[model samples]
Target chain A: MKNLTLALAATIGFLHADPLPSWNKSDSKQSIISFVDKVTDAGSPDYVAPAHRIATFDNDGTLWSEQPMYFQAYYIFDRIKQLAPEHPEWKEKEPFASVLKGDLNSALAGGEKALLEMAMATHANITEDEFSKSVADWLATTKHPKTGIAYTDMVFQPMLELINYLRLNDFKVFIVSGGGIDFVRVFSESAYGIPPERVIGSSIKAKFEIRDGKPVVIKTPEIDLIDDKVGKPVGIHRYIGSRPIFAAGNSDGDYQMLQYTSAGEGPRFGLIVHHTDADREFAYDRDSHVGQLNKALDDSKTQNWTIVDMKKDWKIIYPEYIESTPSQ
Target chain B: MKNLTLALAATIGFLHADPLPSWNKSDSKQSIISFVDKVTDAGSPDYVAPAHRIATFDNDGTLWSEQPMYFQAYYIFDRIKQLAPEHPEWKEKEPFASVLKGDLNSALAGGEKALLEMAMATHANITEDEFSKSVADWLATTKHPKTGIAYTDMVFQPMLELINYLRLNDFKVFIVSGGGIDFVRVFSESAYGIPPERVIGSSIKAKFEIRDGKPVVIKTPEIDLIDDKVGKPVGIHRYIGSRPIFAAGNSDGDYQMLQYTSAGEGPRFGLIVHHTDADREFAYDRDSHVGQLNKALDDSKTQNWTIVDMKKDWKIIYPEYIESTPSQ
Candidate 1:
């Protein structure tokens, strides 16, 4: 009878313990567990096939930091500085001039209009292959301004474990963001273990042709697709064909994605990662400049979507400090 | 001296006998073995990461027979006849009139131009979900005209084995074809073990909106994308965002796919399935009305792509028959 009592206590302790030791079981962590459990429990009639199990995550804030300015915007700024000698005219351009002068705040002060101009100038005219190479090269050397770590390493450790866990269970995980597809494709494999092909994001218009006896596709300035908000569902339908059973996001931009995924028939899961830990991480939601998480919070309560309090659930923020070697 | 003589005689007898028991070891089979050896052997410099391994295959000829007409065309014809009662005007229309009168040859005599009309009439206006269900219903009952076997059973067995082998090796295989995405998505899983999300194909326009307090994306008649021939590479780039490392095709329409895949700066593999067994299956290429293989044949020689001789490499065509199943 004593042995049975001890065994039951041990089982209860294991069940309550963090299933993912790599993750810090904060509020964000709890939300992920609750959502995954509801969708993955076969006994509850919510079990999904390994094939139908798909989870799409927004990258910038949902997976990593997108503080004062977007991470891609910083990448674009650096790229402009590096390519300034090649295109002297950029020094005199409106947004480019501001960016070159080290005034990103003023450059993007005009909001979407200025951002579009900067994006178009930097991203256009190059072959898609060249753009991919450039992004890869930049990511290899560039470090985040605050963390002093490579931008790639700044990804949330808990989120990375969630991604791997979902994949282990046969879920086809994808990164769907408003960021350029080429930019994210570079380090997605090394950082998130999500292959380049599985990452679907924004894209520039491109044309396929044979040049110098070699086939090449060139990225043009014309906006082909913007994968955000309503565009998320459209892009998902266009690329993935089937509706995802699970979705995770940290901003209002992801509301539609969660809605589309949760509204589907059969088992479904939706989660919103609320950045509530200011000391360990940035904490801004309703009135934040980047990655606003207000509308989603209201929707979370009404729609019964799991809301993740980042500070409470996560025991650690990044994987690097957890072990001596970062790669593991 | 007598014992040595006996040993030499035994060695000679062993050499005279065929080494491979089940396989015929024809040129086509040898090519497959050589390619798989180079890619899979870790000792070889050509070894690739399972994650980076991507293989794309054309559908109509590579997977199944597209003889008298594309099997989907036959399905559309049957669909038109079945759905004709709802629309009395379809009986009076030119293409529909010819289709209803059982003069399929005359109706499709105009070729692609006539086929487009039939496709548009049969596939438009319904919600994407409704259209998918319709396709599923059709496939459940549809049988091939010649062998009286279900069309799904007509899928080539050896090719199916290749798909499974590639997947086992961590290759992310995709089906890039000109077929309607919805139609192919219906039966691709049961036939090829490829889920709907991995199948990238031609698409009609769709619009997303809230209907009856719920979000729904509706399909439209306007052709949005065509994934065939030159368009195959474009579709692959748009949907997958990564160049495939290996490609397989059976016709000229897949030429660009092979070209785009093989053109990547790495060890690449390209194979063309050449139909040469008229006794067991239909064997028309080059000048064939459907699934022309001329351009691919010409490029295969120029580009040094492997050509798979159906009669030589495959002991069995379809999976249903065990008598002709290849041993290895």
Candidate 2:
């Protein structure tokens, strides 16, 4: 009888030591565990073939905090300032002048077009190698405002655990983001364990040519594809060539991707990361300008998507900040 | 001593049974084997990490045969005829009329523009699901003209062995083709063991919308992207994100892809399948109307790209035809 009690205690202890240590033992966490268990169990009807076990995650708020505007926006703002010296007329220009003058809201008042112009100016017309190096250099030096930590160090501990868990279960995880492809690719592998090839995101047209006695692929300012909202599903179709079996996102940008994935003819899972912690992390949902979760939040209940409330569902948020490799 | 002798003789006989039975003992085959060995060997300075061991192959002439016009061109012609009763105006059209009248040469005289019109007509303006179904239906019934065998059965045996060998060495093989994305995806898995997610090809634009109380992504008639010539490298960049380490093709349409791949840092490989066997397969290059191999053929020598002479290198062109499954 003592031996039986000891065995039972050991089993209970093992069960409590779950894979997602940062996630609180909530129903949302349970749902993720249960779904993974069902899909991985070969004896169960939900068993998916290893090759088809694909899971995609949105990179911005879903993987890291997107508060105080997108981190890439800050990069673009800094880029505008850097280019201002070359463009002497920028002191009088509307968006560029405003950006250089430290008025971000006015610079963004022109909406997507202004943002796109900034993205094009900063992200294109250079060789692919130069752009990659610039992104890596920026990521190495940039820090989040509130946390005063490197942007890469602001990755969610819970999401990191989830990625590791999914990979362990034979799931090939992909980063499907609205951010620039190169921007996301710069640190995705180091921060999220997702390699550059598996990342699907917005792109600018690139031209392959021989120049200066060397073959080079150059990124042009022309927009090639967008991977947001309705475009997300289209991007997934074009890049992945198949719908993902699992998807997770934080905003309406990922609504269509989740719809496309869940609509597939098999058991699937969708997650919405709800920002609900005001102390540890900024909390905003319906009214937030950046990473707004409105339509997706409204439909999560109807669609049976797990709404992961940050305050309630997470025992820990970001990993302990560490700038391991200093490049710049 | 007799038992040991017998064992030694059996080991020697097994070793003599070559892995690539359809490939003759030629320089091209030796080059492929040697390159793969060097890259895969852990002790070698040329060793590449498993995740970076990407290999891309062109579909048409490189994998099978694209002799008497592309197989997809025949499918488009058949589709034009099948839809003729509905669209009576097609009978008076130059390209469509020529296609229906069985004058393939006159039909193709209109060149790329004419082919684009047919592709837009038959391959788009329907739901993605419907388009995929139509491709599958056509491939299920189609047969090669000379072999009278199912098109899927015409896959090259040596290429099959090479694919298997690469997979064994942890290389992720992808089909980077100029053919229709949905069309290649249908047979890629069954014929080559490459899943739909790994196939990258040309695609028409698709948009997501709600219809009949169900959401569906519909294929639009507008040409979204082409995956040939200079566009091949663009497609590879937009889909794979990372440049492939190894690339293979058989025509000028693949020139940019091979250049982009081989230009990358490290021990890269590029291969061109030269169609020199007129008796077994069609042989036309430099001045050929279809699968023209002009500039690429000339550049291969200077670029250090291995050119596989089909007549001298391949002992067997295609695998023995066998349709294991009946058409739907």
Q: lDDT winner among the candidates?
A: 2
TM-score of chain A of each: 0.90, 0.93
Show the lowest summed lDDT stretch of 10 residues, model 2 chain B. Answer: B9-18
Best by DockQ: 2
Candidate 2 accuracy as lDDT: 0.84
- What tens-digit string does per-residue lDDT give for candidate 2 at B120-200? 888876777777778789888888777677777778777888888789889989999999887798789988998887888
Q: Write the per-residue lDDT of candidate 1 for residues A287-327, one digit (tens) a residue.
A: 98789888888878677677767787676777756334333
Candidate 2, residues A1-328, lDDT tens digits: the string is 9967755543453354467877776788889988888889899999998878989999999999898889899889988887788888889987888998999999999988899998998888788778888878888887777677888888899999999999999998989999998888878889998888788888899887887866677899999788899888877777766778899999998899888888887789999999999998889999988888999888887888889999999977887444343324
Clash pairs (backbone) in predicted model 1: A24-A314, A24-A315, A25-A313, A26-A312, A26-A313, A26-A314, A27-A312, A27-A313
Q: By how many angstroms RMSD does model 2 differ from the true structure?
A: 4.3
Error of 2 at B199 (Å): 1.9
Residue B141 lDDT, candidate 1, scale 0-100: 82
Cand. 2 TM to true fold: 0.91
For model 2 chain A, where is the 10-residue window of minimal lDDT? Answer: A319-328
Superposed by TM-score, candidate 1 places the C-alpha of residue A125 at a distance from the truth, in angstroms, of 3.2
